[model samples]
Target: MTDDAGLLEETAEDLFEDAPCGYLTTRLDGTIVRVNRTFETWTGLRRVELLGRRRFQDLLAPGGRIYHETHYAPLLRMQGSVREIALELVRADGSRLAALVNSTLVTDASGRPRVIKTTVFDATDRRGYEQELLRARRREQEIAQHLQRSLLSGDLPATDGLEVAVAYRPAVAGIEVGGDWYDAFWLDDGESVGFVVGDVVGRGLEAAATMGQLRSALRALASTGLQPGPLLDALDGYARRHGVGQMTTLAYAELRLRTRRLRLACAGHPPPVLVAPGARPELLGEGRSLPLDAHAVRSARAEATLTLPAGAGVLLYTDGLIERRGRSLSDGLDRLLAEVASQDDQAPAALAPAVVHALHDPGHADDVCLLAVRIR
Candidate 1:
């Protein structure tokens, strides 16, 4: 060979031995024919121990060996090449290392496969980063769950002449905790019951914090015996003062058991549904009012009064209950009414679960909060 050709071959040999990735050449039957210095160092095996004596498959961990025999080798043989794939390699001392491997068939001048050329890249750092990302996601979910529990009122308050039950179901499992909340507490007189159901516009910790603030402020105001309309007005004022953006929907109601009367007010929220004894369930119609943060914009006030006869129940719910994607609001309302009408005679507690199940379906796409009050 000419001197220049010899120099070129020497340079190529040096580059292959010091390449960043591990390289190996194996006979078609799997005997290792040649290996780069990087491969020998990475496996803690000297060239003498690896060359001609061991096969490429011998370096793989047990599971990787099985996968190679069952899938990788067959696919490579059919396709003539295999791209980057994750696999575990067993080192000389029996330790395992994660790696990405790429392999291709080497053919002779006769167009027949003679050997397999494989490149291995360490993936331990990439795997560590992936594990870190999963841990961060899990931590975020844990914090969200804690915030959701804190946003909830510990227990349903006992009220005179009323049976109240509340249920909250998140849209997704694990990460399902969200900003929907319900509260039932007695006014100062201790004879009147005031309740509110509301939803924050978003999810996660920020929404949960806003929910907590709104629920606390509303409860504090309701304790002073404000009627439904005035109570919501107070809430709107508080929301504006706090600079809470246009991101809230709420329905507030007060039940006067002495007179079997209910006064309700809504702020850009779905109207409450009332089920009377031996009567169909119907939504209480009230005027439309803007949600809390829309205070700057002139909006109409909403109020309605209904007489709750003995054995009737009033339901306050978040939009998640009757709302479904690709369905009109009217259609959702109709479905809710049908479901309520089909229920058997049951108390508010039992009826609450039935209503939730009725709203339950693969089509439901949001979190739900349901609060029911029955006049005994």
Candidate 2:
């Protein structure tokens, strides 16, 4: 060979040996046939012990071995290549190395499968970053939870011959908290009480914060003796001026104990369930309007009124209680009505959780907030 050709050959060999990533050639069945010095250096396993003795899949963690059999091997054969599969390698010391792997199926002259060539990049730094992110997300979720608890902490208005209760549950499947909230407070008139359940749009810390702001605003507005409809109207202006909680939905109601009069208004919220003595549970599907701050031009919101008999009850809740993927809203509503009907005789405290437990789907990715009030 010419001297320059020998120099080029030597350079190529050195490059393969000292490359930044691990390189290996294995038989179609994963028996290691050849490996670079970098692979030996990274795994603390000498080439002599690896070549022809250890299979490539044997070097992986147990879970990765299963993944290799189920996904990696199948895809490599079918597609002739696979890229960026994350896995963990079991090193000689029994420690783990996170790796991003790429592999190609080598074929013979007639396109028959012959061998597999693989490259692995050390993902320790990337793995560490991802772990730190998860930890940070968990910490933020805890903080938002604390904030949510503090914002929701308070007593519902209960007087003689009146009972009030509430239940709140966050989502089960995600790292971020949701924006569902509930409240009940006595109006200026001692005989009347105001209560609400609302869902602010969005998630995480900002959603919780928006829920707090809207909850406080609604309470403040309700204290002015404003009825539910006008109260929501004022709340819409507050949200627009403050640029928060736009498109939020809530059900607000006032119950007068002396007269047993019930008035409710919905701002693009789910209808409240009404339970009266000697009657089947039914939806109060009136007094509905658009969600808060939904339109550029504001109009007067609507309110519905009804006279409740003694021993009647009302349920106000966020949509999370009933909504599920692939399920119609009316179906959810129907299920909720059925659940409420089953708990007809229960008091507000017992009924709140009973209805929630019955309707809350563990796999649903949303927060649920329910408020129940009964007049004795």
Candidate 3:
């Protein structure tokens, strides 16, 4: 060879010997024919121990060896090459190292298989980074749960003649706290009681904060002997006064035990469900009224009526309970009614948890809140 050719060959050999990645050449029968110094160092095996005595599959971890024999080797033989794929290799002391492997089949001049060439990249750093990211995400979810608990305490006030039960579930399992809330309390007159269930428009801290503010305002106003409609008007005024224009849906009701009746109002919210003894669930207070903050000086009114002798339960829920992508609101309500009809007794306290569970889809992308009240 000429001097320049000799120099080029020497440079190539040096590069192959000390390259950052592991490299190997094996005969058709899977015996290692040649291996770079980097491969020898990575596996902690000497060149003599690796070259004719070991096969490439022998360096793989157990699972990797099985995968190579079953899928990778056959694929390489058929396709001539395989690109970067994650795998693990066994070290001399039986420890494993994460790696990305690339392999190709080499053919001789007679068109017969001669050798298999492979390159392996150390992926330990990348794997470590991925694990750290997953840990950080779990920590963030933990913090979010803490914040949710702080925002919405799990305490509901007891009211006379009302058996109230609430169930709140976020669409995401790890995040159960949401902006949906239920409240019940005796009005100042002590002759009447008020209950409200509402949903703030988003999720997380901001939505929960808004929910707390609205709930507090509603309770304060409802306690003043104001009827359901006027109370909601006052709430709308508060929303306007505070420049809180975010959309909210709510159903509020005042019960007069002496009259055996309830005054209900809906503000761009789902109708309250009334389940009577041996009867199908029916939607109450379906009047059209704009949601709070939809317009200044809104003229929303409460629909007042007496409960039937067979009065059993009332259910109020956020859209999450019945809303689904591509499904109409009426259809969702129909599904909820079907579920309610199938149940015996149909008391709010009994059906609330079941409804929440039935509506919760692990793949659902929205939050849900349900409040049920059964009166004897």
Candidate 4:
């Protein structure tokens, strides 16, 4: 042969033997007929052991063998080819290799199946990366859940002539913990109690962290003896200055037990529902304004106040309680009035959960927070 022709033939043989991927051929019944150098090198098995003594399925893990017969074999027979099927193979030393496999069925001149040709590519690194990503997502969810539980854990104010209760449900999507939260705590020793239900603007751990900060700030601002309207104004300032919880929505209320005076304010949030003695439920909408940090500055927040006749009830909640897709806000408010009207006579301790169970839309794509208080 000429030198150039000899060199070209030698390079072709070398490429077939030392290609990056494993290559092999098996008989129609899957008996090993031929294998390249790369296949023997990959599985740590020699040509002598594989030829006529073993089949391709013998190199698969036990579970992979079943998958090969049930899914892979039939698919190749019917379609003449299969691509990117993932499977595990057992090496000669009992270790395993994660691989992506592709195959084609070869036919002879008689138009009958002659052999199956397959290419195998290693996939261990890719599989490891996917597992690590899933683990990271799980860890973030756990941390958010733990932080939320700790922030919400506490006792409600209980005293003579007053009853207080709160109900909360996380978002239905487990993608992340939500930003909704509720608090009912004492402003003074026993005379007044403060109620708060707030929602941060986003989801996941960042939203939970921002919520913790806002909850703490609101509680601190309320302790300064400010009424609901002024307290909300101060909270708006706090949020703007800290550059945290921008556009957060919330409702704040202070109830005086002895006098039955209820003061409430809102920031782009759902209005509080009031059920007076012998009257239909109504929403206190006079005190609402845009959410925190909506603009640089604006008119001071206005608060709504009314005398809560003895045995009257007030229900405060976040948007998830009444809102639904393709429904008007007024419709949600009207529906909420009906739900509260039904439970006007129930004890405060039972009112929150009952209204939540009745009016809360499980289909809403956000968290739910409700606080119910009754004057005794």
List clash counts for every candidate, in order.
0, 0, 0, 0
TM of each candidate vs. truth: 0.80, 0.84, 0.69, 0.82
lDDT of 1 by residue, 237-261 (tens): 8888887635699988888778888
Best-first order by lDDT? 2, 4, 1, 3
* 277-307 per-residue lDDT for model 2 (tens digits): 8888899999999999999888999999999
**Tens-digit per-residue lDDT, 125-225, candidate 4:** 98789779999999998999888888888998887777888888888855798989888898954688998888898888888899899889888988889
lDDT of 2: 0.91
Candidate 3: misplaced stretches above 4 Å?
Answer: 1-10, 25-34, 51-90, 93-98, 102-117, 149-153, 167-194, 199-245, 254-263, 277-280, 285-312, 324-326, 356-368
Q: Give the backbone clash total of model 1.
A: 0
lDDT of 4: 0.87
Evaluate model 3: give its TM-score: 0.69
Model 2 TM-score on a 0 to 1 scale: 0.84
Cα distance off (Å), candidate 2, residue 133: 2.8
- Ten contiguous residues with the weakest lDDT in model 2: 337-346
Local distance difference test scores for all models: 0.83, 0.91, 0.78, 0.87
- Candidate that scores best on TM-score: 2
